[model samples]
Target chain A: MSVVRITTLSKSISNLFKSLVSPLALNSFFVLLITLNISAQDVDIAKGKSLYNANCASCHKLNKKLIGPALKGVSAKYDKEWLYAWIKNSAAMIKAGDEQAIAIYEEYNKVAMNAFPQLSNEDIDNILAYTDYVPEPVATSTTVSGAQSSTGEPSLANDIILGLLIVVLLVLVTMLYLVTKTLTSIAEKNGIKIDQPKSEPFSIWKAFIKNQFLIFSSVVLLLLSSAYFAYGYMMQIGVDQGYMPVQPIHYSHKIHSGANQIECQYCHSSARVSKHSGIPSLNVCMNCHENIAEYNGEEDLEKGYTKEFYTNEIKKLYKAVGWNEETQSYTGDTEPVKWVRIHNLPDFVYFNHAQHVSVAGVDCNKCHGPVEEMEILYQYSSLTMGWCIDCHRDSNVKVKDNEYYTKIHEELSKKYGVEELTIAQMGGLECGKCHY
Target chain B: MKKITFFSVMILMSFLTLSCFDQSKPNYQFFPNMYESVGYSTYQESDAFANGIEAQLPVDGTISRGWVPYDYPDTNEGYELAKKELLSPLEVNDENLSKGKELYNIYCAVCHGSKGDGQGILMKREKFLGIPSYADRDITEGSTYHVLMYGRNLMGSHASQVNAEERWQISQYVISLREKLIK
Candidate 1:
């Protein structure tokens, strides 16, 4: 009986060990799987960095505020889902009477946060992840100075490589020429007889008449050259791509658009609705210059008329509009500001600023090529038919959740099976759309 | 054979050279005016009158060489179609609206109210009354466009404060706010 009991007890102990060990192993396997999934879903830090610079870096610092609240610890304050919702549509949430949102709104003295509904959930997640995983801050001056020094690294390396390549190519060509010359001289010195080339059996005129291939090639070359020249001539027939004219006043787009970040609409207010982005009159300048009275930049100051320069420009506007700054009133001697218009399309062609700016949702930078970045805003795009059509062909229309395009969306889906609909697909390139 | 070949080559080169040579200078064309054409004794003569008319008639000859006629039709349908297809400019999107609203409140809310109710401090202070609530007006895209173009009532034209499209966008936002208020 005791022997039997000992065997049974040993079996039971072994069974218990088996059950415990099996569960632990399974548990570890699941834990490993979960960890892998989380890592896979973790935000891409690189993308986050770029998105931050493009959108958020202008206003908010990681640890301090420039224009908006510091974004650091923002991820900790809100859950991922809440943060995404808040970032995407903060105003809407506040309007919907979310208490937390309202408190934040009130705390900021009702200064509304800009809505970013266009941002995908993934993008917001990435931004949040970036905020959460703050790398230790490097010393600002060191990094900035280091960046300045490193700026020339790529260009310097490229120059050195290019110079070396040219030298090597020159040496190779020289060697080949020298070798050929030496061989020819050696052959001549050895008195090796070389045959003179055979002449054509026919007369020169007759030979030219007989050579069909040569004739055909000559005709083809002529036609090709003519066609190439004609094509270039036709392309530039109406397009004033780099038409930088001397303006009546030396208004620098580079100053206003580029450095100040004063919006294009600040001056060209008519872009949204009118066919023309009407040049702002002198009165518009008076709106701001009335108060500013001086150019704050060192360059403007160095140009001798620091105080008198702006005063003179304002006076010019005053002369146009007949305003007296001393009286802070209109003198009625106002002459209309004769702003030399830029970006002139042909009279035959009709271009509307409103359509591009307001409806299709293209940024001025897309066509104007970073006017804010320009010192003197020149016409960046060719503003040609081909250029317009090419953009229409490539650029996708902004149609996400827009009620204005609900019918269009339905029709487009039916026609193209819900593929990405570009502007060209929407008859943007139709001749009547532009030419008329 | 060599001499013949050389002579033919020379002839062919000469033919190529001769084809491009134009010795004559281009003549400047002079077009006389109709009045000049009917000059001297016939200048003052008129078919309607039996006797001599005015001594000189206005000359008509120097027509604009570069002038091209406007080709597009200007009918109502054409205008409407053009307006719909090419003129209905886009406004600020959700992204820009947020930014616009932020900008608006900073600059405009002091006078226009957060809701654009026109009950802003200026209104409250009795400085500027009758600042219309966007809802109160029968504002279409066109009418809204007109008001923005030429300032209505007491408010001066905001042409300076915003660009044309931005004003339109602000109009869109105002319309949107109006819709919200109605809701």
Candidate 2:
């Protein structure tokens, strides 16, 4: 009992000490204590941090309210024995009509906390210690600056070299001009007449105009080139191949698909079964975004995609979904996000995402380009008849594991006298296949 | 002077034509009637709806085709009851397990970890914290389905993305992962 009292007293003193010292000083003090290998409490704190992250972090945050209340300095609010009982089985305490437990349960909309019967009293103490632990401010700015400088060096040197080359070229040109000017002046002074061939070249345009054959041929050439250009321009009409539109919300495919490695079909799930790939509803965004309210990943500062910018975009999502971050509830007022469509096929064309994505096992990247790498999505394919026909002519129909194609694949391969049958041979290039 | 004027005019015309190409806007179609659908397309904007959007929520109490109604309430008591009583309707087989694995990898594996070890890429990157491992949790097939139907805590309901059969398949896969973890 005396030992317990003494440890409690020590804990109070440490808590007071923690409040008094600045982060830098406290960190230094901790380093000194750790090096001395005398502070067992510090070790407990470390263990507590890991334990807290493993068990408590999902619902409880130290400085902010998540599913539960902010748990910072929780030890100060309740008795140690009571906390132990509560952590072990809060539902039991609530049912038993414990005032504190019931109050908490009611306060958080009767959302009962998950009981950690697996965690012992010692582990709870460690977790509590972790909750009270104040992390030292890391020297991340210095490291970031160092990285920026290192990466900036090559580009900076290249710019300097480029500027030097330009300056040299300018100097050479000026020197040539100066030399020619001085020589001309000297020649004039020395009475050496420098004949200027100016009028003859100026009349060359007139001479060309006078030649009817040359004029006619040139006019024909101009007309043919203009016709060719007009045809090229006409062909490109309504073919939105690189048509990138800014979305209502800035959704970075690079971060989600590339950095996070989330599969394309995870959000565009209808691609497996439906005609359209389907623009994911706002609820899909909430699947991951509900927990991840802030941006902690990489940033492109030059493009103004900062942590705050990304976080604000998330706030826009919350607004559209009508999610109140503080209370963690929907306000029942929703503004549907009007996402601009990037890829569109004309009404005349019949295209099924499921046919390509699931049946054929065609990769999304084959048409969508490297969507994982794109920060902004754009139409990668021209979606023209020629483009479709080209792919159908070259690409083989995926026959493996498809029972429906078993007999047809064999017959077609035999008829074509080829080892494999292209999609065109499989009637993919038929006019009726795409046009209805 | 006339030639210079003509050349300047040509340059100006070229610049005017080239500058008209705006990437943000769609290009001019040969025939708007043919290019655009006369019938309402997916996500088309029309004055027919009150919300000024094409997609409308289903009428109250109207069930969609193939959508099985989930009777379990979204409450702590419901969670406990579901955990205790809910059973998988689908039979355990290689086909279901394989399909479950594929779906799980696409959706659950992002944060839940592929091995159900609570050490997914998101966890490692510190995006999500305190994701309990399947072995650590007191879970059953029922609880897993319940959680998937009406998402518990931070997770949102994936019912929209996956159907009932897919959910059961995923639940079976999760149980299998838990079994593997126990060993």
Candidate 3:
């Protein structure tokens, strides 16, 4: 139902062959190109795009200034002959001391542009024409820019449900009171003895208190409740398994790792070779945040976040990084984002990230839990010594061609007469292994 | 009046209990000594030094052990010189090249495309522009190492992120990528 433009086709066609290896394929591709090139009128934008992607896209874009100035409306800036000569060989023109060529080289801090010597004059013209060609803007996705999903306002639904329940309860109470009043009135009319309802409550309370069975049951109830609360309170101490603190930046691991599928090591890169799983520095955040300055997707307010909330959170990153969107440059007015640490272990215990991640080959989720699904990161594991001992007792060392584990693995396997050795056998459970 | 007072007190009691239930706050610690420790926490400042400097960096000009010195200075002349002279110490083996490719994908491929064609996701999405293809230019291992050591133009130095050997590995990978682009 959508239009498939030649530009998209050209992009795909070029992508089909990653790098031109076969001479036959190249010749046939060129022949196909020449046949497709026979469109006499429409300015050859598709061919130009193909040529541009092959020759120039790696370095230049239509609107943005990357390693060089933007190429949009570039044809208007230079005449045909000058453009052809420049495109054919800029180095020669620069050496010849051509003013324009030298100025362009000087403008971008002397970063040289590659020459397209093989491109014909017409080919260059087509490329210049494509530079002027504009693609139609696509409609914004329903997910990002549309009527928000129902979950966007969860509190309203909860409030309505609560209000309805309260109304129903009030109505039920009123009906019961009316029925009882009517029954009393009928009894009085019939000349029957209608005893006062007030005295009944006190008599019932007194009789219940006098019963030994009731007293024993009350004591049992009190004991059970005390034991329950006491056990719950005692168990909560020093075990912050679900401790999820509010961070300075609202960085959702779910959106990043779950939705985006970014590998954990991409951010926490030092996990593979360091003692500490180092928190990602601001530069790493800048890698993606520099571009993704706003959230466009529909955010669920049910999660206590609005669409604007996420966009504003991204603005917080910009403020910390000191990046100005207009100029697209850092202002050098930087501040460190103080992230709240969640998983804290006792000082006496020793743990090395590189040992587990690099050597043992333990998945990050084995300890960190399903971090990708965590919107707000929590201390998923107990991080207790018992938790550590249990894992070491059960898990085996990843000893496949691992030079670090070769000698130890050989000795342990041979001695134990087992193909695989659990970490405990490799002295993992030793008190000195952790406490020291 | 007594029933009204009792209901008000119950409501007040519930409100008080609700205030104590903060899910974001960590549970009460058992032993302060066992949890808190006698030592200062990471990144915490202490007033031991006269200037209140917490960083215990060695007195100026003393390099830590195992830190090899790079001869090139952070200048354009140094870049040009390194480009002309710098050679990778590591042999061009599959393992080194593979590692180099992996590192390149992590660091460089964000701005420099995976194929070293400069159309990385950032470039395609129009975040950063004008990244040159590896095939387009004449680059050597020295230049790559020097660039990694001291970033040129918009790119920043990656010396802190990657070590000397890793830089060489990345350089080797880039050279191979350049070869592919040239074809």
**Per-residue error at A14 for model 3, in Å?**
57
What are the clashing pairs of model 2?
A: none
lDDT of each candidate versus the true structure: 0.62, 0.90, 0.79
Off by over 4 Å in 1: A1-223, A300-311, B1-183
lDDT of 1 by residue, A220-301 (tens): 9999988986685555544555555555565667665555445677567667557777766565665444333345442432
lDDT of 3 by residue, A1-436 (tens): 1356877887887877655557778899999887677555345788888888767764566787655778999989987799899989988999999999999989877776667788898888788879997776666465445445544446678899999999999999999999999998999899999655687678988999899999999999999988996796677677888788899999999877776556677788888779888888777776666546668554765565777898899889889889886556789897667778787787777789998887777889999999999889998888877788898899888888788889988998999999999989989888898887
Candidate 2 scores an fnat of: 0.86
Q: Comparing to the true complex, what docking class would candidate 1 get?
A: incorrect
- Sorted by lDDT (best first), the order is 2, 3, 1
**TM-score, structure 2 vs. true:** 0.85
Q: Report the first chain's TM-score for all candidates.
A: 0.48, 0.79, 0.72
C-alpha DockQ of every model: 0.03, 0.73, 0.29
Residue A411 of model 1 has an lDDT of 95
Give the per-residue lDDT digits (tens) of candidate 2, residues A338-395: 8999888899999999999989889999999999899999888888889989999999
Error of 2 at A201 (Å): 3.2
